[model samples]
Target: MIQKTLYLLLFFSSFSFSQFDDLDLTPADSLMQEGKIKDAIIEFETNYQKGNRDTNYLYNYACALAEDSQFDKSFAILRESLDLEIKLNPLFDPDFLNLRTDKRWNSFEDELISKIELEYKTIIVDKEYAKKLWKMRALDQAYYFQIHLAERKIGKNTTVVNTLWKVKNNINKENLEKLEKLIQQKGFPKKSLVGNNAVQAAFLIIQHADLQTQKKYVSTIEDLCKKKEADSQSFAYLYDRIEISEGRPQKYGTQVKYNKENQQYELYPLVDKEKVDFWRKEIGLSPINEYLSGYGIKI
Candidate 1:
């Protein structure tokens, strides 16, 4: 179970991204998640037309095309995604299973891997630490893919869900301990020191940590953001996480609560609903609506 999760979820975390500053495609993402392939394609194309060229968005668009058995179209989009420097590995992604049967798949896969390797070669510092951070990220998200399955197969309050959370909590605690020690030794990994992917992993470890840990490192993250060493979206999410944890309304609507009764997601309280986008724009984040749409969430 753990190995499967790692393989399947690894692509989602393998690359740290800067392209997320573009418009959000949550509506399309939600449609794809529900297997509404045609709707998702339409939504994705609309977002693409509107200038949402983020590699993650393109990857999902390609997946929707593949799910619809539009291999040629999907491959074209995958090529476009590669041009955008997508870090996802299609070999392990179940969404591209159908594409594997195509004669063009092997060559495309080789090209994709080669390009990914070429990009990785650009990481001049902390290569080993970056690899370690990627593994940490893999562990951080490894069990999340099973939570919904557990909830559906049994129930949210069942031992299955409890065990998943317990395991994830343990992983988070362990990652946090390692991260703090790294910070003490290396003074927080930045892009120049450890490359963007590793820095992103470090940020994610802190983001997944407990409230006290977040509070302790929030200023450090903010400092990194100010120096342009970290992505503002990271700080935005962490800021909202800290706010929501402290019982204060979030400023950027980056935090959401899953309403299991409705089987939907809803944003946490916002500090100012009207000016939220302004605040988000100030920090290089997408508007709250665009951000919420990715989660199928509404204001």
Candidate 2:
């Protein structure tokens, strides 16, 4: 019974989508992004009343309320969120800065963290390993965004952008070394070992590694995906990467490249253009057109 309960918790916590992915929240999100906080709250409330009561919606609604200084309503919505998702670290969110001043904030934070700890302690076999992976994931992504920022603000070929790429490559190399050692010693941290996020983080490290490293782990990833131990989307990304590296048309169409001549992003060569959407759906990915749209590539 305990094993089943832990499995259930891991499944739900691992798969809860974010607000950005929830189409129903888009109107409120657009309003929030446009600095119309009160209007965003009203739109969010409208969605909630219409039965769009997912975890992401609730959390973002609470954030919108908190941003508008509606602390009591935000607190109530957040308390509702606790029952919907195993959200972590409510105490540190900038959106809840106003909530922090209220006397009830301390108890609310304690209750939130305590609930998460209770659930995580059951499923995460090695808390320290999970923490380490979280840090590694942060470092893995930190430089990429900075490199993009540098490319946009500074010239793409300028010293600042070049230096950022060099730094990022060095960090990737260091992260890969650590990840290889961890995989060697611990044998690919599965969901049960370090929790879902850590497992995904470890996979991201592998994804950033050289083609050979990605190839080395491809079969293992396939096995994990088959067993529901790892995310299928991660497997799709790695598979597409390997195919592109091997000079073959990708099967899932997850690989994209920037067209220097056209100033647009385009999908990589696919094994079968006509059936790419079918292949993507087989692996839990969206249609190729929809997926590439996120990269500014229209069908």
Clashes of 1: 2
Instruction: List candidate 2 stretches off by more than 4 Å.
Output: 1-114, 117-122, 296-299
Model 2 per-residue lDDT tens digits across residues 65-141: 87678889999887787687776634434356567778987677556646776976655567667656765665555
Candidates in order have lDDT scores of 0.68, 0.69
Per-residue alpha-carbon lDDT of model 1 for 1-299, expressed as tens digits? Answer: 11112232121122121121123437776554444669979998998899988776787788778878999999988788768764645544546656777899767755654566577775336655654565566556544645655665688899778988887788778988887877787688887765666677777777766678879888987998899887777788788878887899988877766688999877778899999999989988777788678668767
TM agreement with the true structure for every prediction: 0.61, 0.63
- All candidates: CA RMSD (Å): 9.7, 9.1
Off by over 4 Å in 1: 1-121, 260-264, 294-299
